[model samples]
Target: MTNTIIEFKNVTKQYDNDSPVLDHVSFEIERGKFYTLLGPSGCGKTTILRLIAGFTEASVGDIYFDGKKMNDVPANKRQVNTVFQDYALFPHLNVFENVAFGLRIKKLKESVIKQKVQEALTFVNLAGYENREIREMSGGQRQRVAIARAIVNEPEVILLDEPLSALDLKLRTEMQYELRELQRRLGITFIFVTHDQEEALAMSDEIFVLNRGKIQQSGTPIDIYDEPINRFVADFIGESNIVEGRMIEDYLVEFVGGRFECVDQGLNPNEAVEIVIRPEDLEITTKERGKLKVKVDSQLFRGVHYEISCYDEDQNEWLVHSTKKANVGDEIGLYFDPEAIHVMRFGESEADFDRRLEAYDHGDAHEQ
Candidate 1:
């Protein structure tokens, strides 16, 4: 028996000859795992959520649930519920009525509806606020009410469409923890959509990073951050210092008039490539002890660390995160381990990229 709860087989969502919202997307979601669709606006993350929720249909390919095709399933017929970005609660109804609305529509017994609504609200820490009007609830409270309503239906899967986008930072962070815990306790699949990279990293067990109607990459947050497939995935996931480079041979790359040792292999000799070095991986030292010399152009104190900007001799910008202060206009040396270098090709497919990474991780690439 397989554990797959949901699957998209070559799904593409296009509209009226406009560019496709989703382009031949395929993925599987295991039961009880938290998955995030992460991307920028109009990149099709929300469209994916809509498709899964049955609010919209895929223009091509099939969607499956537990190996059964669900292309014809209507929104209300699917065993899934959605929490929208706007909270979508009824202003005229109090908390109890709002949460009980779904049950009432089904003509469920009042006793059963009451019991379910109570449990749902209490689980979301909204106990004893049954009579509170939607207008009276704070933004966070309204969000809780919305969630309570979704859970009241006993959904097998929940689709959260940027539900935390409206809350202030502190509340949003709190909700991240709360939502994660809720998913754990319920043991149901959660498909969340968000463009916030930090939110996706903090919450998702797996992430699908999307761009321009296509899935650029999908993996664990750590995997995406540590071994991004290309410049787009690397730059979109977080800040990086990417520079043009050339592969001199196996494990040697030349960049900025300097040759350095790296772990990557199996590329053509003298192949052009891109190098990604993370800001936090950079260590600042005296010029004499550094592998690269750069002049500090500016520095800003960012509470947790100083975000320093510098320029090398070739005028390429390098960003560094450090706790130690460096005066602007001062020349400094930057040191990074050989393993810090992540080499990328110009146009690598996800399959080839994953294969290459797996080769390196399993000691196969080293043999090349």
Candidate 2:
């Protein structure tokens, strides 16, 4: 049976008579899955989390938790907890008291509260740090304390608002894995909010790409990365080479740079479109034998691979993820299999990217 723990039905949020922050947003979050609200900084991803936590009310529409309406409910009355980006741990409380703060409010017995707090700490891998002060712990440890505090109450849902944003890259990556594992083990719904596409893609069981206060696309990481609904999602989620193109037919497209066959089909004949190619999807070679020829503009050596930039005859710049070395001004043949091409229709506004992506489906979508 499908267990949808949270539902947003035509939810919208507006601060004033101006444009709404969340506009008619609707989706279902299944229980025991890790979902991410991903987008740029002002995209209203955090607003969704806040609304779910009852921190704010929807300007329109309704929010449901376990089939119960939450319109009049307050944050404290909801069976949910939030872990903020700042950790929000008390300066005076030690690790034990911090984790046990919620239980203490209920006036629970000393023995029971101690046991629950110890279990929560142990669950978060802070096993013998009951006496450790909050300031003494590392950033990651402190973040874990935040998690422990939230989970100690055993809330029906845990909402994390960029919990790892303040940590270093290495720590952030580590926490991504840990967060996924913890969510799976706990078998609870985890609604996370982040602007980092890599972080969202790495950890989410399902990802909702939000932009301009609305959901642009929602799917697994593989789906969102491999098949972005529109240009905004393609551009936001990762590095993509975008270009203008026209759909020639079901299996073919023509563009300024070149003509190629793609997996995506277009709804309109001769539709003005955009195509996206991931850096890794492109193959670069010094040999002069490929469909598209390019001049290497620059190369960056990352630890695992080199990110090389190239420009084709149309003066359109593209990026390729390669291990091969090449210098600026080096003419090279960039090879890509037919399957790499993706097509998108030209959008009038930024939100059009999301609207287009939401309309996009697999089985050969194209970006020119």
Candidate 3:
């Protein structure tokens, strides 16, 4: 049987004289998966984490853990631990003592505490560093120590609140891999909070993209990247060439003064919509043989590919990533497949977006 580890149902959090930090948010977390709450600062990602950790009370709605309501649960009573951003180890304590502090406070036997601390350190690959003082450890070492301390409690869920934000880029990248691997090894639920899109893309089994106190979308990395529900999601998840358009029919869309075939459906005829095409999906070709003619405006060499900017007759700018070079002021053709065009309606709720997608999928299956 599949067990649900955590759930937030219509949860809202508000402070005095300010708007709600989280407005009617709802989601679920399954056991033993890596879930990331991704958004900019003040988008309520941290608030969700705090609510789950029992550090704050929700202004409205209920929270659940393992099918039990947790609205009034205290921090220490919950079976969860947090690895804070600063790796909050005691500066004066050695690694072993630091990891065993919680157990000691609970009046556990000395021998049991020692065994658990040793096991936690070994789990974090720090078995030989028990006697080292916190001040004597590197940043990565300190992070592992924090993980060790948290796991020593044997919590079923671990909350990582941007724990890698303090590390350098190289170490941060290295730790990303390590954290994902550690989660799989432990087979425990990990709820990671981050504003970094790349980190969320790389590590999350599921991602909840938040903005302005609401969850904009939730899905796997590839699902969100390829089929953004709206403009905000498209612009937030990655680089996209989004333009205003109209859905002409089930498989036709018009943008930049041309009607093009597309793979999307379930929109009203001539309904105003936005279209997104990834930069890498566009190819450059001779103007005479291309579907759309564009003039090169600028280009930047981005190591693996050149990011070229072009303008069409309607002055709509398009960003194209390609391996070949193109001269500025030259007219070129932008080629893309019908399946590459993703159509999104304005102000569509997630429920509506999902229903439309279901309709399109059912229609396609019927045809096939």
Candidate 4:
């Protein structure tokens, strides 16, 4: 049996006279997994988080938690806790009292609050900092305190609203690992909201890519990165080399003034499509032996690899990540495998795109 912890059924959020913030969005979140709502500003990712946290109500759909309707449930009544972006710590209180505030509000015994606060602090690796004031703590430490406060409440779901956005790059990366490990240890559902693609990809068990008040795609990080449903998803999830193309036939496509073999099929003859190839997949080689000849337009060292940009005869730019550096304006050959090409049809709905891709994938599996 699948343990679905949260379900959003055609949820929409609209205010007086304004357009819907979330337009008929529907998705299911399973228990004990890290999920991320990822998108740029005004994309409604935060709106979905607010709805789930009971901070805001959905305008046009039902929300369910553990098989119970939550449309009218109060925020305090819901079994969810939130860690806001700013950490929301109390400057006047010490760490212990800040963490104990919720328990104190619940009128728990003083001894019980003390024990739970201690345990929570220890859980977040802040056992000895209970006496420290919030102002004395570092950004990462205060963030942990916010988490400790949430976990001390024993909520079934934890919502993180871009909590690491304020930290330095190194600390943010460290917290990413810490957050993932903490979720696993606690064995509860964690809904993380972030606009950072790398953070989402690193921390989420699954990711929902949102845009224009709708989810463009949802899947495991690998699945979303490798098989984006459309041009927006392809461009948003990671660095992609997208180009206009035409599907010549099953397992074949034409792009960059040349025909190439791909794994996509079931499209109408001569249908216009877009092709995606990751920069890491393109190889640099001699022009005479390469599949495509291009001149190095620019190059930059990206610490781990050289980000080389090349332009083919038709002026279509191809971005490649390679270990070898190339001189500017030099002609170079690029090689790519047939399987690297992914054809996306123009104007296909997300459902239709997913269905067609799944069908063709199953057919390929059967043949093998």
Question: In model 2, what is the error at residue 58, expressed in angstroms?
Answer: 0.9
Clash count in backbone of candidate 4: 0
For each candidate, give its TM-score against the true structure: 0.94, 0.94, 0.93, 0.94
Between 2 and 4, whose lDDT is larger?
A: 4
Kindly list the per-residue Cα lDDT of model 4 for residues 1-368, writing each as its tens digit: 56999999989999888989998888899999999999999999999989998898888999999999999999999999999999999999999999999999999999999999999999999999989999999999999999999999999999999999999999999999999999999999999999999999999999999898987777889878887877888999889999898988899899988999888787778999999999999999999888899999999999999999999999989999999999998999999998788887787776875565445333442211
Report, for all candidates in order, the number of backbone clashes.
0, 14, 0, 0
**Tens-digit lDDT string for candidate 2 (146-236):** 9999999999899999999999999989999999999998999999999888898889999999888888777889888987777788999
lDDT of model 1 at residue 79? Answer: 91
Give a tens-digit lDDT track for model 3, residues 217-290: 77789878888867878999989999999999999999988899998887789998999999999999998777
Question: For model 1, what is the error of residue 174's alpha carbon versus the real structure, in angstroms, after optimal superposition?
Answer: 1.3
Whole-model lDDT for model 4 versus the true structure? 0.91
Query: On a 0 to 1 TM-score scale, where does candidate 4 land against the true structure?
Result: 0.94
Candidate 3 TM-score versus the reference: 0.93
278: Cα error in model 2, Å: 0.7
The C-alpha stretches of model 1 lying farther than 4 A from their native spots are 347-368
Top-scoring candidate (TM-score): 4
> Runs in model 3 with CA error above 4 Å?
347-368
- Cα-based lDDT for every prediction: 0.90, 0.87, 0.90, 0.91
